[model samples]
Target: MDWLNYHHLLYFWVVAHEGSVSRASEVMHVTPATVSIQIRELEKALGVRLFRKAGRGLVLTEMGEAVYRYASEIFAMGRELIDMVRGRPLGQPLLFRVGIKDVMPKVVAYKLIEPTLNMPEQVRLVCREGDFSGLVADLAVHRLDVVLSDTPLDPNLKVRAFSHLLGESEVVILGERKLAQRLKENFPDSLDRAPWLLPTDNNVLRRSLDLWFADHNFHPVIRGEFEDSAMLKIAGKAGVGVFAVAAAIRSEVETMYGVELIGKIPSIKERFYAISAERKLKHPGVVAISEAARKRLQ
Candidate 1:
């Protein structure tokens, strides 16, 4: 390519960031026609189309997203450069962007991220929660520094990421004080027909618990199905029914939910992973979380 023009790149970046030429022009204090001309010049310089219209909105094409990521970083660095040269004493905090799978237990997620807050280096943490697939998609695009999930990346899926096992622990079955006292009489057998709050089928722990239940023939009547693990715990705390939680965060759950522990399911354990681009972790915050989790959970 010929010598690049930072001006054209800036215009294209704003347009991509705003998702509309008109919006970008408003922010740039220029006309929509000027923004359009700049973007066209950028596309010609880069030799790749950046965006496509999707109905009323402009959406980034695959190449557009890739270019946007690079441009975002470049402009961010440029801003930092000015601050440093001016001796502004404005230190930019390191970004620790983590993507959490929707099914991950809230307590567990807190435990994992808590270490970043204590890092000696100033860190700005950002967390995004969604399904495994969507989070992986974000990770693939450099949007996420790391991904915390219950299950490893699917081998069938073509995501170029590796899973670092954080830790694993048995699960605890908890219920309200009254239900716990009543169920404590017969214990394991008592849960056979008891009302139970369960995670949806999308959760790995749920599938593992299903197998354990089948093996022991402990079929509890499903009281509710929740897509969010935190909601399931909330419902469980409200006496909706008994529910299971990772033993790693059992104490936190009991305290937060004010629930009594009924029993432990050691046979069915819940596993946690930190998915990232590197085979071996390099991020100090991520390393701290993984190290602390292994030591604490074990």
Candidate 2:
């Protein structure tokens, strides 16, 4: 059985955090040479160079950054354990990391994630936003507890992930007050040849909207395309064009962006999913989000 040398690991952790051997030596009350020797031994055991010289300062290598993350968690738990043994109240919050697909509506994401804050345990929520595939890649390696996306996991990605559909929302057309007022009476017919702000073709909502347009034979004048939902709504607020949002967040959109609903298309639904590496969700924060989002979206 191989045993890890926690003392050597401690030295490496301090050096990484302090960003220099000399500073770490001061923190540890040890000579710079002693700190250097301890870190070298740790690197030898781990078979990775944790730091590299950049100009006059030292920086962590790629592997070092990963190690530093683990070290941070390990030390945090160590302190918590000490507090537990002493019957002191634990101050550390449970860390819940989530990834959001860039195309996911910000209001929708906020609604879905809001429940985790009300959980019994103290939770520190961390959110990252990126493209779908990139977020899925983070989920595959366990960097993200779960990913919130408008679409389900693609089987072709070769990742072992399960997509739990939270719920679906009817699509709603929205525009600035005057534009919505002009179109409300005519509804679907009013949309024909109307200046339209749309999601780029790559988005699932865009594709669904395209299908709906074809089905109704409504030809909208495309004024602009956006990948960001917020930007699209901003343009709509300026009356640049009409836009679509999930009915689930219609009220929020109206309040936040000051846009009025032009019409609702129940036939066009926007679905949301919580994609996780686990076949069954086991994290408390994730479970809270999934349960609450399903109810909210429904």
- Against the true structure, what is each candidate's TM-score? 0.71, 0.70
Give the distance in Å from residue 51's predicted Cα in candidate 1 to where it truly belongs: 20
lDDT for each residue of candidate 1 in 139-194, tens digit (9 for 90 to 100): 75457878998899887554457899999988889999998888877778888989
Best by lDDT: 2
Model 2, 111: alpha-carbon shift in Å?
0.8
**What is the per-residue lDDT of model 2 for residues 14-77, given as tens digits with 9 covering 90 to 100?**
7876678998888678999999999999899989999999987799899998887777567545
The Cα local distance difference test for each model comes to 0.83, 0.86
Model 2 CA RMSD to the hidden true structure, in angstroms: 8.3
Separately for all candidates shown, the number of backbone clashes (residues 3 or more apart, or on different chains) is 0, 0
Using TM-score, give the best candidate's number: 1
Model 2 lDDT vs. the true structure?
0.86
